[model samples]
Target: MTEQNVDLGKNPRANRIPWPPLLLIASIAAGALATWVWPLPWPGINDGPAHGVGLGFGVAGIALIVWAIITLRKRGTTFLPDGTATSLVTSGPFARFRNPIYLGDALIVLSIAEITHSIWFVAAALLFGILVTALQIVPEERHLESQFGDAYLDYKSRTRRWI
Candidate 1:
């Protein structure tokens, strides 16, 4: 709304809302909560191939999350987007996409929809994606830009935000 309400700090979560946990909550709410709150007319997929594909996506999403966390550990930086940054991470899954963990979350949410065959879950997942991108990722990116300056700009120029 007003410039006074805006925060352009390198660590923008000064308001105390952590990004990673918020994203985790969003994904869970999107998938799990929606699954229960709005049960599908036809729950569960019977086809073997479809189940395999859904399982594969879910597993891949988990793998990406694991890899991203490992990379963050290797970089000596916390995974929380709003946390203090020890280093500019640009390796492993990060080389491919800036927000691998968030991408993983999206995949997980999507996988839930696929596995459950729930259009409502899909809607929730989509809402999760949109909300995270707007409320979290944008601010985190601004924080990074403030923190890392040209280096972050260069990386932003090079890497896709999501892949």
Candidate 2:
């Protein structure tokens, strides 16, 4: 079998273990722990306004995930870790943001930070977000560029990294 075929058969590291998803899970766990252990000073109104905002961000993040899934399904594509794209997706949320899911995740993290009113937590979230984007998304884009050529270039030119 060819190397590509071998790659397809073997469970690649990226496919088997996705760091971004894992990081996000870890961040959420840490945030929840901080909420219980560190217990930030709650706002005057305990009607859970902060919680509501955090929930809103969570909802947005979920929506973005759905958007990404829909786009991938519609295009019959997969953004595999091995830098493979069966098709290009330029519709739906992809039309607006090149990395909507990442942005949504960042927003969710930021909201959690706000809800907890922990500067340290906020900083941690921001740093984690930046690291994930740089390490994960940037490389994915490079792969996409290599795969799609000028079409990908034009798409990159038109779409913002985050919106």
> Tens digit of lDDT per residue, candidate 1, span 1-163?
0011123344644224665567667666666766677676745567989878878878988999999999888877778765655567888998999889888887877777777787666676677778778877888777777667777788889999888
The C-alpha TM-scores of every prediction are 0.81, 0.73
Clashes of each: 0, 0
Model 2 deviation from the true structure expressed as Cα RMSD, one decimal place: 5.8
Error of 1 at 80 (Å): 1.8
Quick one: best TM-score, which candidate?
Answer: 1
TM-score of 1: 0.81
lDDT values, one for every candidate? 0.73, 0.66
* Lowest summed lDDT window (length 10), candidate 1: 1-10
Candidate 2 displacement at residue 33 in angstroms:
4.8
Assess the local accuracy of residue 136 in candidate 2 as a C-alpha lDDT between 0 and 100. Answer: 78
C-alpha lDDT of residue 15 in model 1: 24
